[model samples]
Target: MQTVKPALPRPVVAVICDRISYFQHNVHAVPETYLRALHEAAGVMPVLIPACPELLDLSTLLATVDGVLLPGSPSNVAAERYKAEPLPKETLMDLHRDETVFSLLPSVTAQGIPLMAICRGFQEVNVFYGGTLHRAVHERADAIDHREGDHARAIEEWYEDSHLVSVTPGGLLATLSGTQAVRVNSLHHQGVDRLGKGLRIEAFALDGLIEAFTAPDAPGLVLGLQWHPEMSLGHSPLAQQLFTTFGDSCRRRQQSRLCTKSTGGNDEFISAYAV
Candidate 1:
């Protein structure tokens, strides 16, 4: 008889898609990079949320998944969401994605879903909870110019480690990175000016700009990184740890959910996850 392989459980992670214009038509799409990394890097099954919030059942989606990934995007979140004036320079803005994500923030944080917010996603997390961001963070007097340079180059070149960010001691990041500092790619123009409620700093750049944070109050893992861990797959231990830690959390959540169901537990938490 042939030996059979055990089936690996894929922890489901909801990936928030962005609205984009393609082939002269507007549609919702998730970047391939995010999907690839979710599967290959994070060891999770990604379910794309392409439609507006009105179409999707949030509870149904949330109950099934172990985590949520808010990926970076070309367009920036509208400033009006956080009661700020628009950027002085012309910038691409996506109200559709902004609306969708902003609506989802409450349930994600409230339910304590594992969340990994990146780049533009970083800004969204801030705005979602009454936090503000510098319109042009690089120009801010106290912070370093964190933008990826003006020279046009291939995508791979842009993601290389550019500067070192000091991971806050005794925090999650410091533990994960196994050190006090880590190099990260700087490709964003907007950064946190004021943190959101229930959020705490995880890492900061050399010039004192917030690079990563965690929600200490939340039940599950809620990490927001200014740098792109998804892009730093094999080479960086910190990046790999970020995904592995998240993947492990999702796995535990999946196990807990299954155990709750298998044990005939009919409590509030069990009922919720059983979705």
Candidate 2:
């Protein structure tokens, strides 16, 4: 009998971001707080992909990455794109960031790349796939109190309570969480109105707001949650599981790349375990 050796893991992930500015102009700027949380969740290094003003091919960024963690941000998606009236108060929308992620989603999914969308990333993922948003969740008072605190406050202390989200039976979220209802911190004013094509709602809030969704037709790990899991990754087992799963997928993707390279760039000879 022959003994088998386990394969090695991949390198850093390319984390896509919008424009970022600091109050004090410094030579070197640090990673955003939420991004740091994502880095800790995945337990891997991060390669920041800044928002480019020029319309560049997203393939350039996707080629060097194994997985993508689409983090939340202060920016909101433009109402014009969704064909809705702008609210009296709306956050700035970064068109460059929107174009890059929108263009890469289908390609990334086709390549079986693992993706985790958080907050605005979640909303964008849906819109990219032909979904719609509520624009302002609180415009209707019957909806749940999705807004927890003032957005201008400190990021860590922004959330107040852990709201309950009922997970659908036989759903990916249910399998991962092993619970019918999970407590998640909320911090968004917009949510899914009409689900995107080929997507199934996985979880919802007490007031029936869409909390989580997944593409039933997606090849690899594709999950979008409206909450900020990265913020709670350190304290929540569920959040930790989410990151670990993503990291494990990335590791597998990296291993596959290495095996292909070792085989003279011919993937036909690669073993199934390479993936």
Candidate 3:
């Protein structure tokens, strides 16, 4: 009789949330649509993590999860935190969500966890690591028209083709996209100005706005893109590649976790058994 092999566990990616106000009640929430697309694109199950303003020790959550997915949200980070004036009109701000994620990022990166940051997540990752934002791109000195029309009104407008971005040579994004220029969906008004510590700019908009960044020194994957790959998954091979690469990294991390557990901290046992 043939010996049976045990099945491996599916990797879990934590999707961080932002504050949402509905019916006079405030709550931390993430869009179900984005979560669905992430699962479809990456083949990993997502766990929604509510926005918490208090500093969180990530070890508890990291022990059970393989990777992190920072989703986009309507709430903007308060300019006061970055020593800049507020936007003309103060957009909704979530102190708790911003504080929690900002506090947890260093520990997360230290553990060498794979992080996939989209839109606001991208901004958060940048700001958390000693970077600054443009606040409102249109208000800046040299800005391009970036806001895609309102969601309900722009469904038929093809917002995804609003901008073209160029990837930097020898960057991970350049290798992933297989070409310098790629058309991307744009719905953001804030962008990175000075890059974060240990990060390198990977791509930029045709108008010279920072579009993507990555931490080259990080042990695991640490990538941030200004556009929404979740929204463009159906039509963009590059979008698929982004999620697939992240999911593959998560799987490898999961396998390493299992190996460590099975070996009971015995390095020689893990090495021999892994081979």
lDDT, residue 184, model 2 = 90
In angstroms, give how far residue 161 of model 2 lies from its true place: 3.5
lDDT of 2 by residue, 26-139 (tens): 222224765576566776667776566254556666566788877776678766666678744646676677776766777888887878888988998888778888877988
Q: Give the Å shift of residue 89 in candidate 1.
A: 7.7
Provide TM-scores for the models: 0.89, 0.83, 0.90
Pairs of residues clashing in candidate 1: none
Expressed as tens digits, the lDDT of each residue in 122-183 for candidate 3 is 99988887788987787776677777766677563634667889889999888988998999
1-275: candidate 1 lDDT, tens digit per residue: 98444454699999998888899887888878888888887899999887487888887887788889999987888878888887655788888888889888889888777888999988899888779988888787777878888658987888889999998998999888789888999898888999898789988998988899988888888889899888888698878888888888888878676655544344644444443
Name the weakest run of 10 consecutive residues (lDDT summed) in model 2.
25-34
Score each candidate by Cα lDDT. 0.84, 0.75, 0.81
Clashing residue pairs found in predicted model 3? 53-96
Candidate 2: pairs in clash: none
Give the runs in model 3 whose Cα sits over 4 Å from its true position.
53-57, 86-89, 151-159, 262-275
The 10-residue segment with the lowest total lDDT in model 3: 266-275
Cα error, candidate 1, residue 64 (Å): 1.8
